[model samples]
Structures are given as structure tokens and as C-alpha cells.
Target: MNLTLSLAINGGTGTTKKRKQLLRDSIVVDDVMSCDGGDHHSRVVRLLQARERMMAKLEADDPRVAAAAPDDGSGGLRLMHLLLSSVAAAESGDAHAAAAALHEVWRRASFRGGDPAQRVAAYFADALASSRLVVRSSSSSPAAASAAPPTRAERFLAYTMFYQASPIYQLAHFTANQAIVEAFESGGRRRLHVVDFDVSYGFQWPSLIQSLSHAAAASTSRSNSHDDGDGDCAEPVSLRITGLGTSPDELRQTEARLARFASGCPNLRFQFEGIVDDGPDSGCIKVDDDATVVVNLVFPAAAQSSMTSSTREEECSALLARIRSLNPSLVFLVEKDGSGSGGNAKSRGRSSSVLPAFTASLRYFAAVFDSLHECLPADSAERLAIERNHLGTEICDAMASFADYNDNYGGGDDDHVAEPTATSWKQMMERAGLERVELSSRTVSQAKLLLKMKSGGCGGVGFRVIMEGEGGRAMSLGWRDRAQLITTTGWRSRRRSINKAFC
Candidate 1:
């Protein structure tokens, strides 16, 4: 099973000249400029010129609010006028107005585009229509977007902070939640006890809740409405969640979420147990022969293990040994893909190469220079440039970094840490006395489905496996492949019950 993952780099860091060139070449050209000396040409020129003007304004950090003073109804009207004015200037052979209008459009479009090329086109199309061009949206193709939700990098200033906020960290949460749901389904358990090794922000739990609610609701509704209680009937069960974390504050936050969830469903219980900050030593949880689902949502990787005292190898081994001894319905394990940051620069330290280091602070500026050099089709470049300016540096940096990770375009080093693969995770579970069951995985991509887990190892459901406990009585289940769960939820047999549980 292949686990789709993403990476988060420190924001605003400078990309190398080499990286910039690669980014330009990587974009496939879609169309050519068909500018003429008429209204079409004028409009096109106006747009390009507006883009250039906007770029300059943004470069100067102008706060004029959408070229001069922006009014209250600026939502789409102002943008339209701005765009039309540029088009008119360009096509009318007025190079000056055309240039000014193009610049303005370019500056404002970036912010309005929302970091997707499709959105950028939509923004421009709308702007054109506002300008009385009456352009249609079906004229352009779709652009790529980041699979992972966007966030600021300033939060990751420290190594600990950086490690906690990494995209892979969220992937780990996905792995755990996936395991829990699969285990409950196979074990026929009505409840689950999830021992989260580290609960930083509880990012993965929400996804699980959404997916479980969605899948169970859809399945139950469909089955009840369509299935005639024949052999195709799928049973639904409730999930009792218990999360463990070292920070009391975080645990309290998790507890609050449980409280909110409990208001609607009485059967489903969610609890956050705060444990002492020590190495991995099962504080209150014990692996026992009961109808309970026990899991360790911790990473023992050399890279991430250092982030927590309990996540060390020996500690993890002990914890796993105990888990195996208890014989859980299943065990889900996730760690850093490989080791090391893979970037030339170490956390809170110097870079491997002096050139990148010297130019690091100017990454955004360098990107600007590169964009100028690329000289996109007069229309395209203008559109792209204007959009970039409006989005602001912070948002642009986040999007650019996401794009780099999504396409694997930047960073001096190529040695990225591989998260647990299906085979490796399966081996680990088996070695620890757990048997493999069902498996599922999906790649996160805007180009394809953002996220979907295929069933059965390589492609099954949304995770790698849904193992039943071994020993005939209650088989210990696990994923044959090492996968990071991105979503979690419980299966309910009844549609009404599911609606009550989630609604």
C-alpha cells in the first residue's frame, strides 16, 4: 500500500537559481498568444500591462488597496473595471495605459487566485467579465493544488515546533486513525481505546471523524435503503475514543472536543488521558485479552524519536513488546519515512552548501527575478504575476513550498525520509506478533483524487489493512504495509443511529 504524503518547508527561504529554472521548465505550455491590433489585442495588452504595474506596486509594498483607493463594493466590480481598463489600453495602442492596467491586474490577481492555477484563471476570467470582456471560464484548463492544507511556517521556527508541525506528522495521525477503524470493523468491537503516543494539535482525528461519518452515513443509508438484509448487509458499530498525550493542555483541548461530540451521541465516548512526560512506558494502558482495541500512535524513527522521550527505539520496542503480549485486535505503526530532513540545511543550523545559504534569505526575491526571466506568454505572465502579488508573500511562499513538495521540485538534496511502507509496517506488526488483515492506501494529489484509500495492500479502501486478531478466538490485526493514516471513524449498522452519532 502506498501512503500519500506531503512536506512543509520553512517559509520564505530562497530557492536556488537552478531550482527556479527547473520550476519554469516543469510547467507545460497550454496555448499561444493570439493578440491582434483590435479590441482583443488591446484587452490582452491592457491585461499584461496591468500585471506589470501591479507587480511593481506589490514590490514596493504599496498599500493603495487595488490600485488607488479600493471601495467597499470592490468584491468583483472593481476588479472588472481594472481588468477592462487594461484591455482597452492595450488594444487601443495606448502602451502606457495598457502597461498600467496589466500591472494592476497582475498585482491583484494573485491574492484573488487562492494559490491554484484554476482559481487564478477563474479570478482573471471574472475580472475580464467585470471589465465587460464577457470571457468564459471553460476556455482554460485546470491547475494543480496542494493536497495538504496550507499553514504558516513561522510556527515551526524551533526544531521541536518544526518536527511537530511537519506534514508527515499529520500523516502519522492518519495512519493511527485508519488502523483503529479497520480493527474495530474486523474485531466486531463496539468501542476502541486509542493510545496516542503524541497528540500534537490532534490534526488526524478530525479527518477520521469526517471520513467515518461520511462513509458510515453513506454506507448505512445506501444499505438500508437498497440492501434487503441479504448477504450484502454491512453491520455498523459505535466507537469509544481515548486519546493519550503528554501535555495536559493538549489533553484538555482533546477533552473539550470529546465534550462537544458527546452532546449529540451518548454511546460514543471520547476521552483524553494525560500521561507523564517519560519514555514510552504504557502508563495506564495494558495489553489484555479483552474485546478492546489497543494501538500506539507514536513514531520511533531516529529523526522523530528525538522529538519525544517516549518515542525512542528502546522505549518503542518495550511498548510494542507489551502490546504484542496483550495481543490487540491490531497494531498500527508509523514513523518518519527515512531519517534526516533531506534538505541541505539542518534544523536551526547552517546549510550543506554556502551558495544556498548565502542566497537563502532572498529566496522570494530570487523567485521574482526568475518569474520575470521566464517571460510567460504576454497574457499568461501578466496573469501569473498579478496574482502572485495580490496573494502576498506569506501566502505565496506557503503555496510555492507546497508546489515544490507536491512536484518534488526544490531543495538541494533528494534524500527524503520515507514514511513506513506497507511491506515494512506489515513486517513490523508480524514481528511483534500481529497478523495482517486488510490494507488500503492513497496518494494526495490535486491532479488526481485529493485523497482516497484503496483496499487490499497496494490498493484497498483508504488504508493498508483491516486485520482480524489471530489465535482463532480473537486474531490480532495489523497492516502488512507501513502506512500513515489520514482519516478515522466508526462504522454504524443503522442509518438513523449514524445520523444521530454525527449530526
Candidate 2:
């Protein structure tokens, strides 16, 4: 197995690379400054700040941080109205009106408060600000050089906080694992190799290790009751994970963490290898003829963080193509939800895509922000950290289209967010000669059970899970009345036909 990870940021052209400094400097602006929010000076500062965070890979602040401020019942409706007005003003090139709207949003919105809608508005404000503050001055300060990339500790902290606060990571990992486990069980294989495309903190593997260990223990126990001493019926299972990541130190730490956790799983033999994502290309991943191979495509953060990213489809498509070459037993395609024939459109974004994509995410993240109110209290520091340090950066980057990024992308139809006529990921997977595999009953049941355990936090029934697509192979988990936020689907390589002449 071979991999590279440290998810987020631009999906570049061919491969999904780590987000890097392009986002680090852009969105991490000082929420309050001496400069007037409506002035040209303010616009420069906002643009420069957004641009800097764009390079720095930062995000908007947390709404929970501002929960102390009076909401005045203005969170949901007013924020949406302000964002719509801001979009209209920016699109119409009414600089003054846009500035006023932005100013009002800044005044009313809390980047560090507990209102999800208010936080969504803050990010959209950054988006609107980035849209207007495009012309970065050549006289930009020497101090504007990019801050050092986030340390491994910082990235790990962000990944852990989000994983603990939300069911997003758990949903992606457990569902995918179930599919892989079923594939192995049905195929009658004992060795499993999982190549995780984006394995940041290695959070997905511990549960998988435990699951496999339990099955092995149960299998061995049954065999021991019948075999006596006549045969060695040890249901030995070997599991290997090839994780792709951005840095050596983080990868080493993840390897250590996973190894330590796996050590406690007595019946499972586990091996893990962490490789840098950008080191090599096509033939780098070495496969085993004996092991059942699986590809795990869950991104590093968020429910749909990578799903709504601008370049996600092209990058993911290219990735699927590479994985097709490996001909794995199962490919778990996990992403944020979409409405369609299904199994399509892994991306919908603001910058480098279309306006509708931005609007779609604005609505989606608003719900996400609101849902947090149920999951975390207003004053919890973890809530603030998750929003500001992790999700805020992701939301801010969603709207970031650098001044020249459009020049390179050409705004092709393929970049459309969730448009009706968009090219579907289902089509992409099919074109790669991979067939969509149904999510097994066990997978769907486990998904529902997960939500049931966490339902108290987000309110019951609203976060229900349902099987989607024909025969219910696709599973979706979402908040009430809105889009299914995260969907996990399984796929397999189509078995080639035997030659008639040979037969």
C-alpha cells in the first residue's frame, strides 16, 4: 500500500495536493481594526488579509466566540439577506452599496460567536470582501510575507477537534470500513490492504482495527470449539494501511498513534506505512497479489469540506483513474451530499467555480453552523477552536478565488457547482470502468446506529440516516429538512469477461 495526505486546499490540476500556503494568509484577518470597515483602506486590508489567509490556509472565526453578543433574533434570516445583497452588489459592481452591505454584515455578524448563521455570514463576508478586494497593491508590506505553514501539532489539533465535535469524520470512516469489511468477508479474503488517499491524523483506522480484531476473535473462538487440537484454526487476519500525508513528522506521529492503538487489538496483525503525497506518481503504489485491496477517499476534514471544493471533481476523477489502475476490491467514495440520480458531483464551490456553488455552500454551511449550537455549548473553547482553527479556514477558502485563478481555469461547464447539467461523479467512476457497489445492509444499519448515538446532540429524527439510490447502496446522513450533508457510496472494479475462444 502507498499514500499521501494532510488534506484541504487547492486540488490543482492532476492530483489532490495538500492545501499548502495558498490559503494560510488569506482569511485570517483581524476581525476588528482601527481602519473604517467601509473605506478603501479597509478594502485593501480585507483583500490583503483574505489573500494572505488564502496563502496561509486560514479560515473565518467561530460564531460561538461571539455568542455573548446579542443575537436580536437576527441570525438566520438577516444573515441570508445580507449575503444575498452582498452578492448582488458585488456582481453589479456597485462598490458603495457593496461596502455598506459588507459593513452592516461586519457590524452584525460575529466571527467568534455561537450563531451558525452569523458565522456563515462572516465567511460569506470574507468571500464578498475577497471578491471586491481583488487588486492587491504592489506596495503591500514586507510584513505581508506568508506566516510559516501550520505546524503538525496545529493540524493534528484541528483534525482532532472537528472529529470530536461532529460525526462527520466518524460517518465517513465507519461507513467506508463497513463496506470494506463486507467486501473482504464476502470475497473470502483474510488480508486487507487499505490505501487511504487522505490520511491526516490516522483517526479512521483505530476503529477499523478494533472491528477486524473482534471479528477475528469471534472467528477463532468458534473454530477452537470445533477443531480441538486437530488443526490450527486461528482466524488470523492481517491488515495494512498505506496513508498519504503532507509532512514526515505528522505522518510519523500518526503512524505511532495508530500503531499504539493497534497494539491492543490482540487478534489482528497490523502494518502501517506513511508516505508523502507529492513524492511520486502513477506507479508509486506497490500492490500485493495476496491481499484484498481497498481505496478510502475520505478527505482530511469536514463532512463535505473536500466535496464542495472547486477542483474536487477533476482531482478526484484523476485520483479514481489512478486507483482504477490498482483494481482494488472496493473503493469507498465518501462525500458531502448532493441531490441527483446520485453518485456524482463531489465538488460545489464559490471561487474557481460558479456563483450558484457559492450560494449552495452558503446555505449548507449555515445549517452546519446552526447544528453546532446543539452539539456544543456557546462558551465551549473546543467549539470555538473547531470553528475558527479548522472549519472557519475551510469555509473561508471555499470562497477564495485568487485574482488570476480564473485565468487558468477558463470557467468551463465542468466547474459548475451543483447545476442540473453538471458532469456527475457517477459518470466519472463508470468511465473509469468501476461499477457502483451497493452499501450493504450492515453498512446502512451501522450508519443509522451512529446517528442514533449522537442524535441527542443535534435533536432526534432530524439527523436520521437513509439508504439512497436504487436498492439503497448509497447511505446519507443529514440534518432535518435540508440537504443530506454526507453520503457514502461503494464501488468495485468491473470484472472483465472471459474470452469466448478460450471457453
Model 1 stretches with alpha carbons more than 4 Å out: 1-176, 210-238, 262-267, 286-290, 296-303, 306-313, 339-430, 435-438, 441-448, 451-503
TM-score of 2: 0.73
Instruction: Give the per-residue lDDT digits (tens) of candidate 2, residues 367-402.
Output: 566666667777877777676666666654655542
User: Candidate 1 has what TM-score?
Assistant: 0.37
TM-score of each: 0.37, 0.73
Error of 2 at 494 (Å): 1.5
lDDT tens readout by residue for model 1, 1-503: 01111122212212233223322422121012234446555444444444333323222331121223223222222333344343334333344543444444444444333223223323443333223222222222122122122233322222223223222243445545655666656665545555555655455565555555555556667777876667564444344454555667666766676556544543233445555445444355543234455555444322222111122334445655655444455555443222221111111121111111111212222222222222223345443433343323323333233223223322323222122112223333445555533334331121012123222212233223222223211111122222222212111111111111100
Best by TM-score: 2
Q: Name the lDDT value of residue 250 in candidate 1.
A: 61
